[model samples]
Structures are given as C-alpha cells and as structure tokens.
Target chain A: MIDEKELVIALKSQNECERAFQILVNLYKERLYWHIRKIVLNHEDTDDILQNTFIKIYKNIHKFEEKSKLYTWMYRIATNESITFLNKKAKKKNITIEEVKNQLIENLESDIYFEGNQIQILFQKAINTLPQKQQLVFNMKYFEDHTYENLSEILETSVGGLKSSYHIAVKKITAYIKLNETI
Target chain B: MKRRENIDKFKVPTNYFDEFENHLLNKINEEVLPKNIGFKTPTGYFNKLDFNIKRKNNSRLKEGKLIPVVSKKTFMYAASIAAMVLLVFSVLKDATRVYTLEEIEISSIENFINEGNIQLKQHEISILFTDEILNNITSNQSRLSGNQLENYLLENINDLNALLPY
Candidate 1:
C-alpha cells in the first residue's frame, strides 16, 4: 500500500510530483468515480467530472493544508465538482437541480451502464425526492459506509448534523419504499 | 409487597416506548434499498483514464505559460475605442461625405448580425419605415416564388420552427 503522507510529500516535490500523481490516480480513481457516480447517476458525466476533479486536485496540491485526510479533501473536491456540473446542466436547461436529477433517474432505464432492476430504480427515484444534503448524507453513510467523523470532514457538517441528516434520510427512504412497495 | 409495587412504579418517557418499535422497523426497512446501485463503467475505462489525464495535464502545462494576460473584455473595449477614433477621423476628413448601401459589405452586415447587437422586435423594425415604404419593400421583394418558398419551408421546417418566438 502506498503511504498517503509519503505520496503527498512526493506530490509536493518537483521531480516526484508526476509519478506521485499517477499513483494517486491509480489509488483513488475508482473510489472517487463511484462517489461521483452515485450523485450524478450517469457514467459518462461522472467520468468527465472525475477527470476534472483530478485535474483540480493536481493543480491545487500545494494548497492542501493537510488539516484533513488527503482522501477526505479529495472527496470534498469531487463532490463540489459534481454539484457544479449538475448546477450548470440545470441552468442550461432552465430547470431546477432536482428536476435535472429526476431526469437523470428517468434516463437510467435506458442507460447501458445502469444494470439496476425495477426496485433499484425505484430506490433511486426515492433518493431523488430527498433534499440534496440528506441525499448525500444517506448515500455516503448507507452506501459508502463512511463513519460520521469522516462524513463530517468531507461534508463540512458537524457530526451531530450528519447523524441527524442520516437518520432523517433513512426514515424518509424507508417510508418511500414502504409506500411504493405495492407498485 | 410494598417494595415490589414501588419497584414496578418506575415510568418511561411519553411515547418513547411507543415509537421504538416503529423506529426499529424503519431502520430495518432502510436496508431494502439495494446497496449495489447497479452502476458500471465501460471495460478498460479506468485503465485509460490515467493516460488521458496525463496527456491533458501535459498539454495544459505546455499551453499555460503562453496564455495572454489581458482579459477579453479589455481587448473588446480597446477595439471599440479604436473604431470610434477611426470613425471620428474619417468624418472630420470629409464633412459632407455620404455612403451608399453598397459601400457596406454584406459580410460586415452578417458579422454585425452574428455579434447579436441588433435585438429589434418585429414591431420595432416596422416602426423604422413608413407604411408606404414598408408596402413597397414587401411588394418588391418577391425573389422567392410561392413554390420555391414552400419547397424551402418543407426542407427546413424544423429549423424555421426553432427560430419562432413561441
């Protein structure tokens, strides 16, 4: 396993930066890709956002204060990039971001990369109904299995807030599923 | 008997125990949503990603130092001022000179249209000409016969529809 501290040091060094970046890509590309994919719901858009996130990370490595874990900082960047992308799409189409996400969920049926069955699609539809923060909280906590502390760092929310958001999100999702179960 | 009754008298918070079963059930039901969201990437996408990112980074590095420091707005303001100065100089050089429609090139008119500076509504355009002149222009401009117009519309109906306001 590549030590994150050593990687960060090498990334900061002039000669070793490029090699370290390559290692960074190899290490976190899949994790970041999935994290973004859950938010965006489209493979191609997720891929583009992931690339932009990496580019931003590469350019701003010197500004990384190391106050947070490197992964969490990178996750924050990826999350912001994904949200920015969705906001841009919403602006271009003159729709709300929720509408954009709903459209994405609708398109999931036809996406070749989406292997979800009917119930899975319904679950995504339920998640789409949630407020953006709760959706993120639930996805990270329930799907990615992130701890409250790690989530607090990445989301910039307090641990108490994250826990409350996750709790509400879970309750809402459970109600949605139960209500729609007959369908 | 008195001690057993007092021990049994301990009470719980209102609705706490009542809601506990429902909350627990909801927690269990939360698992009904599948963990696998069924997203998959194309084969070899990750393998190719690093190379793509490297190429992009290298290209950016090569082009970074060559970027002009001046913003586009600054260049546009400079161009506008230069054009105004030239116009003033030409008018001073010839006080009574008048230019005909032919003096303005068609490409210049096209460029002006493409620049999006002409935002006149239909009624505003109509207001520019008197009724007689408008009638004359409409009567004189029969370049496309009805058949040709219909054919053109048939070929580009979608494009024409897209250009409509509503």
Candidate 2:
C-alpha cells in the first residue's frame, strides 16, 4: 500500500495526481460504501450515495486540508451524503425519517441481496428503529468497529455522548431483537 | 480449548450470513451500480485519474489536428460580414442624424419648445374652470354644513330624499 503522505504529495504535484487519486479510491471506496450503506440502507441507494460521495471527494480533493486523515474526511462526506439522501427522500415521500427507514427495511427484506441474511436483516431493522443519531453511533461502533475517538472526529460529537448514544441504541436494538426472537 | 469448542455454536459462522451478506458484498463490489441507485458516481473502482488525464489531454491533440486554414477563412469571412453590417448600421445612423427630414423637423420642434416662449391658453382655461367648479363646490358644502335643510328634509321625507340627489 502506498503511504498516505506519499500519496498526498503525489496528488499535490498535478502530474500522476490521477494515479494517486485512483489509489486513494481503491483504498477507501468499499469501506466508505459500507459505512454509507449502513446509514442509508437499501443496496441500490447505498451504491448511488457511495458513487456520489466519491465523486464529491474527487472534485473537492484540492480543498482537503489534510488536517485529518483522508479516510475520516471521506467517511464524514459519505455519512453526510447518506443522511442528506435519506432526508431528501423522506421529504419527497412525505414521511418521517423513521418511516423512510422502515420503508427501506421493508424493501431490504424483499430484496434478493438482503433476503438471505436473516440475522443482519433483523439487526438492521432493529437499528432502523433507533433515532438517527443513535443509529449512526451504533453503526460506527458495531459494524465498523471504529473507536470512540475516531467516531467523535468523524461525527464531530463528543466521545462520551457517542458512547451513551451507542449504549442506548444497543439496548433498544437488543430488546427489539429479543421481542422478535420467537418469530 | 473446551470453552473454545463450546463457543463455536454461538460464534457466527461466516457462511451463515453468506447467502445474503456475500451477495450484497459481491453486488457492492461490482463496478456497475444497481438501478434506482441514487448518485451512481463510480469512485476509485477503476483508474479514474488515468482516464481523466487522457481525456483532458486528448482535447488538445484533437484541437491541433483540425485543419486551421479553411476554418480560419470561414471565420474571417463571417467576421468581415459582421463588421460590414455593423459599419453599415453606424454609417446609416450617422447619415440619418445629419440629413434626415424627420430628425430635422423633430430638432426644430425641440428647439422651438426650448428657446421660444409659448402661452398655454387651453391649460389656463381648464385651470380656471376647475377653480370655479371647486369654489362652487366649497360654497355649496359651507351652505350645507351651516343649514339644517338636509336634516329637516331627512326628517320630513323618507325614500324620496334618499333617492333624490342634492
């Protein structure tokens, strides 16, 4: 793997900047996609939001101050893009964010890609029941296994607040799963 | 070792979620995005940098290959025609300004209006008539305010005074 610092240098040089950018894309694309996917739900929506996030990253690469790691910056963009996509959809469909999430889960359950994984589908559904902030915190911790410090940097929330949010999210999801376990 | 063996049952098997997660992961890994996928901008899946560099530089090469001679002549001809049209317009405008009869008449009318003193008799007549009408109205208003004729009429008559104009 190319050192990120070396890659940044190469990107700044204008020559072979495209090559460096390609490397950055390959390195972070799927990771960013999954992070975005967990937020948005629905594979197709994730794919669209993922592509848009990367395109935005590509266009705004010059603006990146490199004060934070590129991955963190990209993750922030992906999360925000996913949230924005959901908010727009919710507004257009005249539904609350929670309703939008429930609709997404319903689509996911019938989806060929999601129908087979009962556990993840249940887990995702339970997560969807959470408040948007709690859902984000839970995803970053449970699925991505990101540290609180890292999450705080990406989410721009205090680590303690994120931890409590994650705890509440887990408790709610766990109770939901337990309630549904018999079915 | 015993606990580890016992834990295998509780441990999620990689294949357990494979049917869904694997398919999802594979679909996600696919270069092509699924339909209804919003914002399908393929980021970093392929060599975009190389593609962009080639595209950006290709325009220069393409531009260079275009035969400049015929296009230049065509461009010059179009430009010359435009210039001639503009020149004709300006010359015609100047000629009209200097020699046009209508302009001469308009200029003379303007000069006469500016330099000569003229009395507006009709405006004075209208003003005087308006003043006379206003004075008559005010006098009638004063008489109506001072007299109780309207009240007396209202008390005596019913619908006739209401229907009739003073």
Candidate 3:
C-alpha cells in the first residue's frame, strides 16, 4: 500500500507530482471504476467518467484539504462526476433523470458488458426504483461495504442520515425483490 | 408427569415471533439477492487504465501549455481582424445604404420642416439655381418632351401645380 501522506505530498510537489499521480491512478483506478460503474450501470460511460474522475483528481489534488481520507475524497469526486454525467445525459435526451436510469436498466438487457443473469438484472431494476441518494447509499453500503461514517464523508450526509437511508434502502430493495420474484 | 409439567417452561418474550417472520424474510431476501451486480469491463481494462489516464494527463498538460502561448497572439490577431472587419462592414453598410421614399418616415420629414432646417422660400430656392438650370426648367425644348409632359400631367393631375416652376 502506498503511504497516502507521502503520496499526497509528492502529488502536491512539482517535481514528484507526475510519479505520484501514476501511483494514485494505479491504486485507486479499479476501486473508482467499480464505484462509478455501480452508479452509471454502463461500462462505456463508467469508463468515460472514470477517466474524467482521474483527470479531476489530478487537477485538484493540490486543493485536497486532507480532512477526509484520500480514498473517500476520491470517492466523493467519482460520485459527483457520475451524477453530473447522468444529469447531462438526461438533459441531452430530454428525459427525466429517473427515465434515464430506467432507460439504462432497459439497455442493460442488451449490454454485452452485463453478465448478470435475470435475477441480477431484476435486482438492478429494483435498485433503479430507488431515489438517487438511496441508490448511492445502498450501493456503497451493501455492495462496496462502506461504513456509514465513510459514506457520510463521501456523500456529505450525516452518519445518522446515511444509516437511515441505508436501512430504508435495504427494506425497499427487499420488498421490491420479493414483490417481483414471482415474475 | 407433574414434575415434568413443573419444569420451567421455555420462557419466550411476548411478540418476539411477531417480528421474526419479517426478520427471517429479510435475511432470506438478502441472501437470495445476487452479491455481484455482474458488471464487467473489457479484457485487460484495468491494466490499460492507468496508462491511458497518464497519456490523457500528459496530453492535457501539453494542451494547457500550448493554449496560452498560441491563444494570446491568436486572440489579439483575431480580435484585430474582427474589429477591422466590423469597422469595414459598418462603413460599407452606411456608404452603400439606399433609403427608399417609404423608409423616410413622414414624421421625420414633418419634424425637419417644422424645425426650419429646410424652410427655403420659393425665391431663395430659385436663387440657388443658375440661369442655365432655370432655362432648362422652363424651356419647352428641354429633356421632358411635350409627350412626356403630357404623360406626367395625365399621371399626376392632382400634383400638376406643384410640378410647375412657381
């Protein structure tokens, strides 16, 4: 594991910034990729957003305040970038954001990159039914195993709020799955 | 049998089982849901990711540097050219503009006449013309032949008195 402090120091320094950036990318790319993929649900878009997230990180590393963990900070950037991307997409397509998400879920059926079976696909559709914040909280908490505190830091929500969000998300998802399971 | 009945019954909290069904159902649902979302990337995507990002970063840096250097001069040059084009366009626009009689609003003409800017008396107007021009105006053998004069009179019967050199 790279020492985050040293890596940050090197990133802020002109002489070592490039080398440290490579380490940063190598260390966080897959994690960020997965985090972004869960949000956007398409590999190509995830890839584009991942690249943009890294570019943003590289550009803004100097402004990193270190109040949060480096990973969480990066996670925040990835999350915001993904949401912005989706909003732009929705705006471009003249659809609501929810409709865009539903469209994405529908496209997943034909997506070559989606290896999920019918159940998994249905699971994703259920997740798609969630409010955006709940979806984020659920994915990060359930799939990524992020602690409420970490989610709070990444999502800028109170820990208590994140906990409640996750709890409600789990219940809703469970109910959705059960309701749809018969079909 | 009395001794067996006297044995402490397995004490259960009231309503414990009430929520158990829901709890168990939740657990089952959790277990049944797929752990993986089944999203996959292209082969070797991770291996190439860092490299591609670095390449992009380098290109971005190069572009950042190149823009200021090129744009400072280019912008000034462009601005100058655009200003010149605009100046030339405005000058040409004003120079070549033809105003139709309808375009000269009656109100503006009324304003000009009311302002005494063009209140030349008939005698002053006649003085402004040379004798040669005055002869041309009154001459029967001038540019407007008899036929043209008759045609003008026929076409503008109401304005015939205005057409006379009064």
Candidate 4:
C-alpha cells in the first residue's frame, strides 16, 4: 500500500493523479458509503452521495493543502454532502429536516434495500432521536470503531467533546431500546 | 460492552462492496479508468517521484461528460406539457359538446333542470339572445319557450310596445 505521503504526491501530480484517485476510491469507497448510508438510510441516496464525494475529491485534489489527512478531509466532505442531501430532500418534501429523518425511518420498513430486522429498526429509531452531531459521533465511534483522537481530527471536534457526545448518544440509545423492547 | 452489541445488525447484499468500485468505474467511464494495477513500491520511491510526475498526462481520468436524456428540467417540462394537454383536452371536450332540442326528450331536460344540473348563470342566459335572435322573435312573433317572457321583456319590452303602438 502506498503511504499517505506518496498518495498525496501522486494525487497532486497531473500525470499520475487518476491512478492515485482510483487507489483512493478503492480504499475508501465502502467505508464512506456505509458512513453515508447510516445517515441517509437509503441505498440509492448513499450511492449518489458516494459518487459525489469521489467527484468532489477529484475536482479539488489540486486544492488540498494537506493540513489534514486526505481521508479526514474526505470524511468531512461526505458528512456535509449527506446532510445537504437530507436538507434538499426536506425542502423538496416541504418537511423539516427532523421530519425527513422520521420519514426515512418510516420508509425503512418498506424500502427493499433495508435488510435490518426489528431490533435494528429500533436501533435506528433510537439513533434518530439524537441530535445530528451526536448521531455522527456515535456512528463513527461505535460502528466505524474510530478512536476519539481520530474522530476528533476527522470531525474537527475536540476529543473531550466527541467523547461526551458519543457517551450521551450511547446512553440515550440504550434507554430507548430498553423502553421499547418487546418481551 | 455486550457481545451482541458488537455484532453487525445491518447487512448488505453479498459482495456489494467488492463489486462496487469496478461497477462505479464503469458507470463513470468504462474506457478511461485503469483496471489492472499491481502495486509494488520498491525502495527509493522518492527518487523516482520526479520522473513519474514528468511522464505523459494521458492516464489522467477525463471528467465524464454525462449525456442527459430526462433530467429534472426535462421531467418538469414533461409534467407541465401533460398538465397543459389535460387542460386543453378538457376544454375542447366541453366546447365541442352540444344539446339539440330534437335529440332530447323534454322530460330529461326537465329532470336535469329539476336536479339543478342544468342551472345557467344570469349572464349566460343573457347571451342566448343575440340581436338577430331578438329580431327573428319580433318578426315571426312565434313560440315563446323557456322563461322567454323574462328574457324578451328584459331585452325587448320597448321594441314590443313600439310594434304594438297601443
């Protein structure tokens, strides 16, 4: 595997950028797709956001200053794109962003792409109750297994703040699941 | 942490991610994206970096110029055209409809009027008396039908009294 330095250098190079980009896509596509899918809850939407994320990365490669790791920068872009996609959907439907999230949860039962069983559905509903930022923190920390330090860098939050948000999110999810669980 | 919490609840189709990159590449541009790449980075990678940068730019992925058939604007245009077509068809259907006195049994007309389905606006009833129609009524001085007294009196009382001159 090419190290970060070589990847950056190659991505910046006009001649070798495409090959470097392909490598980048191969490495990160699934990770980013899942990241987006958890928020959007729609396979087609995740696919769309994933495509846009890569395209945005390709377009802006020359402008990347490398102050942050490329993956971190890409994650931030993907998160923003997912939020933007949600906001646009809300506007189109004349619903609040919260309502859009609720609608997505409702759609999950009927969505052919959703394979989650009842517990997972309840898990999603619990996650949906958190503030969007906390939801991001929890998903990254819990599912992606991102360390506080890594998530701090990727999310541009202090490690302490990320921890607090994740802790709160976990507690809320637990309470919600227990409150609604069937015997 | 519970053991169950560690297990993944969400699932995707088999090989969904493994098949993703190549399919994505094909969707973007089948011909442009490089398929075969075996990475073996030897020592002195930094030394060859400048040589690699100076090589041909032909490997660069050209932005895929999407050929559009039915985009948002196209769909919107189609919807508006469909709406307009429906509007025109309804209007034309209404305009071309006619009811001749000979085709109707009087009782059906009476039933329609009694049911309030045949109700006409006052202004619409006024339009039934063109100047030619009034002159024909006065010239022939014939059958008066369908609230004809109010219609003729409203329009032609002076003409009637002048013709009687009594």
Best by lDDT: 1
Backbone clashes in candidate 4 total: 0
lDDT per model vs. reference: 0.84, 0.67, 0.82, 0.71
lDDT of 4 by residue, A50-89 (tens): 7767766776777777888888888888887898777667
Instruction: Residues B1-166, candidate 3: write the lDDT tens digits.
Output: 8787767666776666875776566566677678898888899999999888888878888887843556677899999999999999888786767989899999998899889988778898798899999887788566777867754554455222223221
lDDT (tens digit, per residue) of candidate 3 on A52-109? 7898888878778788888887887788778777766776787878899888988988
Chain B TM-score (each prediction, in order): 0.26, 0.19, 0.27, 0.20
Q: Can you give the TM-score per candidate against the true fold?
A: 0.65, 0.57, 0.65, 0.53
lDDT of 3 at B12: 70
Better of 1 and 4 by DockQ: 1
The pairs that clash in candidate 3 are none
Chain A only: TM-score per candidate: 0.97, 0.92, 0.96, 0.96
Model 1, A1-183: lDDT tens digits are 888899999999999999999999999999899999999999989988888788878988888878888998889888877877776678678788999999999999999998999888889988988999889998998888899999998888998788667778888887887899787
Q: What share of the true interface contacts does each candidate keep?
A: 0.58, 0.00, 0.58, 0.00
What lDDT, from 0 to 1, does candidate 3 have? 0.82
Residue A136 displacement in candidate 4 (angstroms)? 0.0
Question: Candidate 3 — which residues are off by over 4 angstroms?
Answer: B1-28, B67-166
**Colliding residue pairs in candidate 2:** A18-B49, A48-B38
Q: Is candidate 1 or candidate 2 better by lDDT?
A: 1
